[model samples]
Target: MSNKDEAITIVSNFLEASMAPDPELAATYMAADVRITFTGGRAMASPQAITDFNSGRYAWVKKALGPFDWTEHEDHTVVYSNGTLYGEWPDGRPFAGNRYLDRFEVRNGRITRMDVWNDSAEWLLTPELNQES
Candidate 1:
């Protein structure tokens, strides 16, 4: 497989491990010095940190993965994963269609950087939007 294909597979596998809440497995796909930033500029030190953050914000969450788009550079590959988030909220309310975009920089078969953005904050601010009307 091409480098790009390998990068995508690495990313997909990481996501699966993450949703499984298997931080140890997820960390396998990342570089030792990986940089991760979540929505609202929250800097994360490790996959465990992500799981901790998610624990406070959501009851349980999973991605409704859409597509993987990538761009190749001289040294690394930039991959973008866009999709909607679906799961239950802290209040035990189920929600879906919360759009999310994740950007990753893969080098040497490991992700060196990851940035995440999502619509959960907006939904939280406007609760009616998530309500079944």
Candidate 2:
């Protein structure tokens, strides 16, 4: 596998681990300094922080990541990823089909920074997403 391919594999495995409900497994892919910026200016700078934020939201978080479709510019590899994460809230209200697009910058095969956008608006607007609020 080329560098990007390897990165994609790692990214895919990361998502798989999340669905495994193993925070330790899921965390291996993240650099200690990994930085993730969600829309609405919500940023998570630590593996623990990101895990904590997502872990509580649903019973299972599953994603299918592929096609990579990337460009390398200077020191940054701009990659576009489309995938869906499925899970449910703590209340036993099931929510699946949460889709997302993520842009990532990888340095030395380590993800340094990321920007993510998702159709979670659908999740949020749904009666399921609203129940939490």
Candidate 3:
């Protein structure tokens, strides 16, 4: 496979892993030296770290990421996605949504870096919007 194809496959597999209770597949996509920055000023190196933090949100809130529209731009591939995250929260609150911008940096065939930014605040305020979400 080409570098672009590898990147897409890695990302797709990672996404599948993310939905599972365990994040093993997600970690496979990352290089050991990978660095990631979450929107909340949380920065981590290992893919496991990324999963550890995100798992908290996923524990009770289900996230359905989808409709990923991809564009092959120069040497990079960008995917624009829209999805729904709907599940009951651990605290018994209905926490069921988040919109996001997920960016990946692929080198060779591994993801060396990733940055995630999302409209978490919007979901925090209104769970109902998730229908039209």
TM per candidate: 0.97, 0.74, 0.72
| Backbone clashes counted, model 3 | 1
Worst 10-residue lDDT window, candidate 3: 88-97
Q: Number of the top candidate by lDDT?
A: 1
**What is residue 71's positional error in candidate 3, in angstroms?**
5.0
The C-alpha lDDT values of all candidates are: 0.95, 0.67, 0.65
Put down candidate 2 lDDT per residue, 1-133, tens digits, no spaces. Answer: 6667766766666656655657677677767788889756689765556667776655545566646677767775666778766566667666555677877766676677778777655665566554333
Models sorted by lDDT, best on top: 1, 2, 3
Q: Is candidate 1 or candidate 2 better by lDDT?
A: 1
> Which residue pairs in candidate 2 collide?
none
- At residue 97, candidate 3 shows an lDDT of 47
Cα lDDT for residue 104, model 2? Answer: 70
Measured on C-alpha atoms, candidate 3 has an lDDT of 0.65
lDDT of 3 by residue, 30-117 (tens): 7788878887878976667766766565445445776555566566665444575566544455554456767777666667777777
Residue ranges of candidate 3 with Cα displaced over 4 Å: 69-82, 125-133
